[model samples]
Target: MYKLLVIEDDVMMSDMLSMYMSGEGYEIKQAENGEQGLKLLEQFVPDVVLLDLMLPDWDGTELCIRMRQHSTVPIMIVSMKSEVSERVQALRAGADDYLCKPFSMHELSARVEALIRRARLMQPNAAGGQQEEAGQASEKEIKLDSERRLLLVRGTFVETTFSEFEIMKLFLTHPGKVFSREDLINAIRGFDSFVTDRAIDVHIVNLRRKVEKNPKEPHYIRTVWGVGYKYVTEVEATR
Candidate 1:
């Protein structure tokens, strides 16, 4: 069975989400604040994380940044703040998917199921026996080809670590698609790889510093106010 972590401050909200997800046959863990959520991540390697943007100790976006520094667990934002800016910011912080509050149970279940399904599909090749062909390709030096690889400022022969390359590949492949820390974790980590979610954010920061012209106000990797990061492309490519 897949295990899930839910980070929410509201006792009732967290309980309801936990119970419903539990009924779905998933092992559910709950945290009242970002601090506790980080601790849970260290102790329990959940398959997916249901993250809330608003937390007592830390904002959800900040938590996402911290978590991305360590892990790639898929994160789905379950929050009440529906502002476009908020959603864009969450995505920029590393959220995989955004879901507004006052949502339906069925919708929640579907979202969780989708996250699990995607996570399974993203497993490392050869049943986790080896790093797999994709990893090897990412590790091996290859020539820079913007059109072929969907790469932007970073070149194919990027002088960076494998973790940074993995994050870049995701953006290149799906330009303009927002990815939170949780999404980054789920998409990159191997099926059996043990890493914290915050670790993912560290990689993102490093990656930006390496590739972006200005990491602070980046042009290639622009943060969505209420969502996550999106790799903006040139107009010629849009056609």
Candidate 2:
């Protein structure tokens, strides 16, 4: 059974989520504040976390940042704040998805299901097999270890978020293919996620910072003027 950790201060809201998500067959754990939530996060190790932005003990974004330092579990921000800036902040803080309050239980369930599905897909190879490596082997060695969900640049592991990893995986698999912002958003978050096009730009920028020696003049992920971005193929990287 997939486990879910819900960190919500609202008593009624927490109860509602527990009841509804339980009915959906997810093993549920609740935390009324940030500190308690962090404790439960380590002990329970849930597959997905449903977090609220307004916590009496801690700011949701800060908590999200802290969580990212220790775990890669998918986080979905369920908050009353509907502003684009607020959503972007949470995403930049390491949230994988965002859902506004007053949401339907059905939609919440669907998003949770999607999160679990993606998590499973990204797990290390089940048979203890060799880690798959894909990338150019020229002066700059870029390697993708799917089993570890890690991106290695010049033999160094570059930390990446779930979305960042997915984007890189896609780029490495199909180098030289131009993917629009919408395409990337859909590919990583799926059509159900509440994400804006600008969010993709933020992800790309963050990714470049980690993968490129100098983000200003990116060599691997090139921006296609007027369209979107693409991973430079071996031949393209040479020029």
TM-score per candidate, chains pooled:
0.59, 0.69
What is the per-residue lDDT of model 2 for residues 1-239, given as tens digits with 9 covering 90 to 100? 88999999999999999999999898999999999999999999999999999999999999999998888898999999988789878876778888998999999999888888766754543221122322324624676765456788888988777688789877776667899998898777632265678888998999889887789999889999889999885457768
Candidate 1, 214: how far from true, in Å? Answer: 24
The positional error of residue 44 in candidate 1, measured at the CA in angstroms, is 0.9
- Alpha carbon deviation, residue 192, candidate 1 (Å): 30
**Candidate No. with top lDDT:** 2
lDDT of 1 by residue, 45-122 (tens): 998899998899998999987887777787888888988788767765666677888999998788778777765654
Worst 10 residues of 2 by lDDT: 125-134
Candidate 2, residue 29: the lDDT equals 98
Q: After superposition, how far is residue 20 of candidate 2 from its true place, in Å?
A: 0.5
Off by over 4 Å in 1: 126-239
- Give all candidates' CA lDDT scores: 0.70, 0.83
Alpha carbon deviation, residue 43, candidate 2 (Å) = 0.9
